[model samples]
Target: MRSVQRVDKCLAAACLVISRHAKFCEGARAMRLLLVTPIYPPTRGGIQTLLYQLTASLPGTDVKVITAKERGWEAHDASSGQLIKRVWVPEVSPLIRNAMFNFAALGALYGWRPDVVLCGHIVASPASWMIAKRFKAAHVVYAYGREIGIRPALAAWALRRSNAAIAISAYTRGELLAAAHGATLPPIHVVSPGVNLPDDIGRCDASRPTVLTVARMRDWYKGHDRLLDALPLVIQEVPNVHWVVIGEGKIRAELERRAKAAALLGNVSFLGEVDEDVKESWLSCAHVFAMPSRYPEDEAGGEGFGIVYLEAGARGLPSVASNIGAPTEVVVDGKTGILVDADSPPAIAAALIRLLTDADYARKLGSAARRRVETGFTWELVGQQLHSVLDEVAIAQSGP
Candidate 1:
């Protein structure tokens, strides 16, 4: 059985090679790559997850990650073929942060002298640009929505200087291009964050009306307050509704207080900082996933792409997200999920109520949502896309 499975895997690889019209398996060869980010795993967030995924995906690639020791880099090593170097940066003050970041980045570049640098945050933009300029190495920047939208001048400079830039969603790409304002921008690509779909939605009852949202309890960008405000109306419409909130943040206390104030304490469950297994269980158990993220003052603090929506969708669960930033890209309006106007509590409430009340409609949307993720949003596919981008950049840089 094991031999047969191995044969099947080999055949699948052959088919992929043929389909892609490749002369050789480009991924088999090791390439020197540097990844810079603000955060990394054991620390929860999209950027951290993305960096880990990118590095882990490329097996033979010599990958190194440079990040600030904000919470202290844990669950990674510098000697496991994948190097993780943490620099102490005072995140509180801008002046100190910039100085520390520049010094640290320069030290990393000087020591490693990697072939390519893939920066994961805009805070590292200046350092990345300088390293690329000085060493003449290929630099690629990953632009999440908030970073690109907030630091327009820095983003523009990085976009112009970097060999290429990757946007997590089409919305982000559009915003980046708009910010550039006809300036010759680098080659930009959209590679949506991927989610691992569970084999079975364990112990979940589809008939029950359960709503899930996996977002930090932040008052501004995450819009948990708005969701809470909308809950009363939703409960009036679908009285049996239950909400599961899976995340931890500074605003958790405030949100809990608000839930009590709004008379939603009994209906809402706060499961703080759940692991992957627990998150999957909740995703499978829930009927719908909702996150109403809103942009905070046109700053780079909006949802670049709500990956939780896809995680829920992958489990044949529909989503109800705000029509803002990358959530608009993640959730297909009326198909995979509903997209309501940002900051409109009534609109959010109405959408959630509609999904809970209409069983058949919700099921259909969920089915479509699952199929969408299965088709294009898996980590395997995302890794392939990134591999191609890296190969192209490498080849271009090696040219006469």
Candidate 2:
């Protein structure tokens, strides 16, 4: 802690010097914004999607990305408007990859200096702060729930140094506050993720009432097991109900085995990691979207903001989600979707059954959800909010 304080003091002194010399000419030229993230598109994760959407949504802002190289990234970048620089780092070790990425980010800032630097993930936080400080640009850091929850000290350190911060949800904001541990922090804006309203994607098989869950099976907190447990009860009520699972991870084989053991093979289909169009099509046809994520026993991690719920909601599908975490904020209980105790298989089962059987009620909720997304959760709105924050921070950093 003492060491941290000393480092903070040193950085603070350096910042005082940089602010006087930092020249920000904003009116005539487009705002040059640099995004430093560990992962980018074709990686298929929430942060990647968020950064990608952010780039597309901000029209006048000149956006550039610095991220680690990923498979098929070149093809994806070829079609993009913004310049994306992929730093080649060995994928075998995360520590090496992150360390190399930071070093690369520091040296990579050669030709163009951005007016603002946004760190997409915590791994890039320090480098982002240094770069922003060097340019006298506004430094912004984003906080996601699990990352902060798992490493409060690190989160606190990053937040203290930033000019501003963005939290994906109120739940994530809470996590950031807790991480501060009574220490002062920068203005933390709660910017819930936005979803794209999909085109008329074709539908899935409607032979039976279908429930869909889209989440990586790598973590236990996503509550796939609980959903699997609820399936038997749901099957008892609606025997022909089909449960389609998307995403792939190490634990998928185990979840499949558990489903098989529970005699849910006939009812459940594990379509591991399908294309985006296919996932959207399932969302369009599925009667209910369910991924009842629960906090682990240690309470170290939970959903920051369940974007999948909004995605399903965008497709006019009512969700059955856990009553805890950011899902409560995303899925309005008894309004847009049914929220239940994720630990209680019966509760999950009941919600699923209720949505499946009562078409009128489900449709009402689904329609409301679609309307909610249309009004509040569109990417355009997200971009505007973010743009405002960036402008505010940049102006403040460039004092009169």
The prediction achieving the highest lDDT against the true structure is: 2
Give residue 395's error in model 1 in angstroms.
1.2
Query: What lDDT does model 1 reach?
Result: 0.79
141-238, model 2: which lDDT tens digit per residue?
A: 98878988777887888899999999999999988998898898899999889999877634454778999999988898898999898888988889
Stretches > 4 Å off in candidate 2: 1-27, 201-205
* Model 2, TM vs. native: 0.92
How many residue pairs clash (N, CA or C atoms closer than 3 angstroms) in each of the candidate models, in the order given?
Answer: 1, 0
Cα error of candidate 2 at position 167, Å: 0.1
Clashing pairs in 2: none
Cα distance off (Å), candidate 1, residue 151: 1.7
| Full-model lDDT for every candidate | 0.79, 0.87
Worst ten-residue run, lDDT, model 2? 19-28
